[model samples]
Target: MTSCDRFLLDQPGGTLNHIRPVPAALFLAASLALTGCSQASSSEASSASEDATTSASAADFPVTIDAANGEVTLDSRPERIVSLSPSATEILFAIGAGDQVIAADEYSTYPAEAPTTDLSAYDPNVEAIAGYEPDLVVIANDTNGIVGALAKLDIPTIVNEAPATVEDGYDGVAALGMATGHVDETAEVVADMRAEVDEGLAAAPQDRLRIYHELDEKLYAASSHSFIGSVYDSLGATNVADAADKQKSGYPQLTEEAVIAADPELIVITDQVSYTADDVANRPGWENVSAVRNGNIVTVDADISSRWGPRLPQLIESIADAMASVKTPVG
Candidate 1:
């Protein structure tokens, strides 16, 4: 995943591993990176077939999935799982498959019990991953063709690419449950998310406040089309960056003049940014901007803002709190 606001580029997994390329490539790269490596080896297939005889039937033995990378077939439930994607790690635990996960990348910090290691999700070491001897490896990006490398060792993998839309996020939750044998839990989590998100967004202002989502200190912004921007859209907010996203690339770098010109009613700065709320308000040309003048700026957690995972409700609630501050209209 290249950083779309999160530098999630070639950030093939976890939350961001953005591909570090042209703007248009961000969306396409994420969807395409995990493709073409969804094959199961003979040993895995033989093992799956054997398990079917123990107590289950064929219906549950050979499950085929159209994952982010391509078509992947799992013979049996994944026992030792290694998650390279931050987003995937969160899903694995939330769906009640935490016990099945043997290891995860260092970026998987939530849940506290996650087996985070020295592994780098971006620069993944296949040998190190192999040391875990995971029955299944999950990733968001192909990253150095690790899929093919693991496949050579008879290891099965599923590419759980980062979500591009709200629905995509739901689909990912369900998919992980399927992969880890937690179908029932997945349903409950998705239902809770949908209901909470609906209730949270219902509290947004009906008049549609103009919002700005800061990606970094360089002034890169998330457009209305981005996954993060979708949260604001669900609340009926207008994205000030939408006008400047000439390429419709979902992420756009803006000039200071453009941000002030838009005069957004709410400015959300990611926590990763060095600039504080006061710094934004003190900028020379921002003195008169509504968000600056009215203290409508919100400092957001970068990880939560960037990843489309189980904690999505937190994002909705955070935005709701910001909306609550807009009692009448600061602008």
Candidate 2:
């Protein structure tokens, strides 16, 4: 089974044995959830199959889709589309649907050309978005309140909830494709992304190393159940944070005591906090940790590492570089 597939199947277990790459079977299972059974059988089954044959055809009219929060349907191709999340904005640009984007949320800064529409000014502004007369609304699942408000206006909206892993990221891309009437282009993009990730993994060293991913200075971290944890799995590293499976949100805080026990060889931090080897070593009881002693603590770009979007390949490579820099004992 591929590492990506294994990651999708792993439950909230606190063991390192479940840390291996995911099998193809698991990848299939994870993907199945993206296309709901009801929609797959009725609307998407025929449309997707037909779309495969006539790949170039666009939707007859502007259509609205709400795949993130739940499945929503639209009548035609939406001419004015508003994206409520940065990830959604990235997906639209990737699938050749950037032209339809009339407005985007505050953080949709990628691709440089995506229209700077301030929905809510910070998050999602249902009223400002409504002002654009968007034929379609692309929202994140977490933006339920805004989605509800837009629904009242009878605007066709597609919601992309948070993707838990890299596969979910691909599914988001495909979902955007269906919404923008560019399924073929979306499929192509996913294929290329999968291939790139595969190549990077193949080139990595065989000795799978132990890693601890620190989300914040508070000792908050991700487990096998989270997408960020899955990314660590893909890069051939074992996540020590997988030991804490109590939190359903995928991120859980670890006691400094628990971290000392796990004693991962490598420590990774996302934020650019002014932390040095001595800072980590001097932590209350973390003085003896191998990662701190060996100066293996590394900080990564939080935006790319945390956000599951089109730049995942870059994130993966950045992680690989960090792993490569770890110092090993001389033979």
> How does each model score on TM-score?
0.81, 0.78
How much does candidate 1 score in TM-score? Answer: 0.81
lDDT by residue (tens digit), candidate 2, 1-331: 3222212221011111111112212222223334432123455554444433233225332333336456466556677998866777877898799999998876677779988654542345666788888988776654437767877899867666657778777766666665667755665566667767777676665567888877656777777668878888877788888778666667777888889999888887755444654577678877678788777888777656656667778878777877878876566
Model 2: weakest 10-residue lDDT segment is 11-20
| Candidate 1 lDDT over residue span 40-71, tens digit each | 23565534323322212213545555676776
Q: What is the lDDT of candidate 1?
A: 0.72
Winning model by lDDT: 1
- In angstroms, what RMSD does candidate 1 have relative to the true structure? 10.4
Q: Report RMSD for candidate 2.
A: 10.0
How accurate locally, in lDDT, is each candidate? 0.72, 0.65
Among these predictions, the greatest TM-score belongs to: 1
